[model samples]
Target: MARAPADSHLTPQATQPGGHVPVMLAEVLDALQPADGGIYLDATFGLGGYAKGILDSAACTVWGLDRDPQAIARGQAMTEAEDGRLHLAEGRFGALDRVLEERGVAPVDGIAFDLGVSSPQLDVAERGFSFRFDGPLDMRMGSDGPTAADVVNELAEGDLARIVRDYGEEKKARRVARAITQARGDKPIQRTGELAEIVRGAVGHARGKAKAHEIDPATRTFQAIRIYVNDELGELERGLAAAERALKPGGRLAVVSFHSLEDRAVKQFLRTRSGDVPRASRHSPDPDPADRLPEPTFRVLFRQAKKPRADEAETNPRARSARLRAAERTAAPAWANFEEGRA
Candidate 1:
């Protein structure tokens, strides 16, 4: 399938009415050229941004999936408004293929994923996705998992350190972990404010002469806890593979990620699937020829990730770090399910 032009446009109305702009909206629409009669999946249907945009663009069908039951409930009115064109399902995108199959849906024409926490999730203090708020330290994207409070209060210091270091890319992960353990020992660190204060107190001193624009010291730690609570990276790995399996031949896959880790995963997946493997590093041994990968199943749409326009970034602070990468599916069969070590 041919890629839609990079300059494909979207009007302001395409965004949800309440100013909830989906990051990289135009670029995503360009990647997934929604056409009449086509079926599309908004894999992370947070606030129904991309799903609403796709519905507005064509007479297509959209299955919007979100693990958060609150999100699904909120979208019911919009689903009814769309007159059967839009369907809302409460489930993780990681199991999108199964969700569709259970509903007797066929392969989709396009799939769009807007990864990471949503504005609603972050803005609502009770949800505990951001350090800015001081509500309960619950960060589970879905209803069932252990909350962020549980993670900080129960995990070994070493385990907490590893999560912060690996997931948040915090250089002083050990220090942060130590502080959390020490603080929680006094009493369970149950609130977002308490945790944020603990993290700030631990690392704020290290930022001796912080620049005016520097982010809060607690940002990384909060992000780390939220990611851990949600198992987000693992879900992305599984979701991407699910998208590959769910799309029909020539189907499009568009993903918008807000940070480097998520973008890196999407980049590596597309590069490897499109047969653009990187040269083996001299320090590493070559892989066995007998363990070759399956045939290419996707054609990468862009050599580099698409970033939000300067104007858009300026207007929407959340769009600043967003990066979009897209690809088109091929006739080749989907590869084996994603394994942790493989990605």
Candidate 2:
């Protein structure tokens, strides 16, 4: 799981030197309830914050997975320090079931996913996850796929507009796309700073004026491009399904999402799998009994998603947007039939 910047008051004064603080650590622990001799999975495993927390909480084993090779390399010392209690794997969380199966691991007692770009990814300008510092427009989370530069330079204006509008939820998507296409026509847009400037010019001009304390005009565009470059939404969908298959009955699942898109996906998945779907009104016709839905595979742990305390949010700006949702796996079989219908 990704950790917040190391400035939060929630961090232990005696925590390992240079440790990154996991967001909502106490709440996540409460949801997972890690116990002795049990196994847990830290599906994101960025900087090993959640994994370390789980290890410190109980005499349990933790399987850490990350798509980024750099993250896996960073975890080597932690794995060794844990005396074989922590195992690190390099793979996307969406393929977690396969990763565990290849290792001959059993179903886990709990799983945690901290979604969105990690702090390191955002802080390192060379990684291109943020425009805060100038860098190449390469936002691929893992090294395998196309970069944000590829999307910005190669995609059609309409396609770019669609991505910004759909993924970023930006209202000025068309203007942004037009600006990108016009600018790229002069030369390939290759840097984060260049794109940020283009977006700011486009949106800022449209607004005619800027207000103090307003968010950067380029924030949504950057978010949209990053999400597109990483196929984040699709990965989240697959990861949730994989988690369903990997978890044991009564096993806990906790997901922390940083944005509405991710949080909505998590919320909808839990609601549908837990049979919390909306009921039909009296005016609606009843469906045939033979078309009955499959048994619920999960039970939601909370009626609503949890947010960080005001103090924690004040201390760490990153934690302000975090939303946590948790649920426990049911004995019912994985939702293979249900997934097919939905697909």
Candidate 3:
């Protein structure tokens, strides 16, 4: 079965001295198929894990992109270690084409995106990604933008419910939203612990109850707030498009998504761009030939997404929910009007 983001546990083996283990390194390598003299892009370079792996796997140049300036700064050592083979850029992956163009890098042979919050971001209490640390409720992936506290304290009850429902997939989003609105009336919900308690009180935590089993009550709400604050889903869609534009023919693209929503976006993007759209049912008439879809721009590497083996998940708990999907850029011109349907 496909896993959710309920498992936020980080095992000791998950990170080494300077970097965390790249989830599904071997699998991603196989999908990317890095070759000598080829250039690759790590669109979500958190700690240079995938970048390092790609550089080591072949005599290729790696250009890493990250929205977080801290990530870009931390990766300088890796750039030096590679003796100019590694180049780190500070920006969202959606702007990857521009970043590459500015750096004089041509269309790359492979591009990889490991979506969602990184381990370092989750570990830092100040970033407020996890409730385990009781820090300020700021979940911005980058240094800019509105913080989680702003959303919690300012959004209307209905808006809050929508975010919790749509992004977090929380069933009790109405109750949670109402509780938040009520609580914030007295004072702004500033700290992670305070907001978590509010959510717990709103959504009862009965161990055996339906939708209230093992996961913490605040998990879904936190995820929703974080995703909203970062505009992660929108970023992923644009990143996929940018990858299409930035990849050479036969260039590979691999993405690792932790939740079902992100995985669905990746699946649909590949399906639509690969000309695998479903035909109208027997009861419905076929479309006109003039309205025919464009040719596929990418060839999917696998019919189904791949997951980590049980042993790997057991060793690094964070890998438990990671889902990998890969594809290759085709010779056709990019689809100009690909639609990203609602989640």
Best by lDDT: 2
Residue range 1-343, candidate 1, lDDT tens digits: 0112344345532356676777777778889989999999998887888888788778899999999999999999889999999998999899999999898885999999998898899999999888787899999899997999899999999999999999999999999999999998899999999998998888875537878568888988888888888999889988998998999999999999888889999998888888787667899887786556778899999899888888877877888888999999999998875452252
- When 2 and 3 are scored with TM-score, the better candidate is 2
Query: Which residue runs of candidate 3 sit more than 4 Å off their true CA positions?
Result: 1-19, 208-213, 281-286, 340-343
Candidate 3 residue lDDT tens string, 58-156 = 888999999999899998888998998999999999889889988889688999899999988999999999998999999998999899999999999
Give candidate 1's whole-model lDDT.
Answer: 0.86
Poorest lDDT segment (10 consecutive residues) of candidate 2? 1-10
Residue 269 lDDT in candidate 1: 83
Q: Candidate 3, overall lDDT?
A: 0.86
Candidate 1 residue spans exceeding 4 A from truth: 1-9, 12-14, 205-212, 279-289, 337-343
**TM-score versus the correct structure, for each prediction:** 0.92, 0.93, 0.91
Off by over 4 Å in 2: 2-19, 205-213, 282-285, 340-343
Candidate that beats the other on TM-score, 1 or 2, i.e. the better one = 2
Angstrom error at residue 114, model 2: 0.3
Backbone-clash count (model 1)? 0
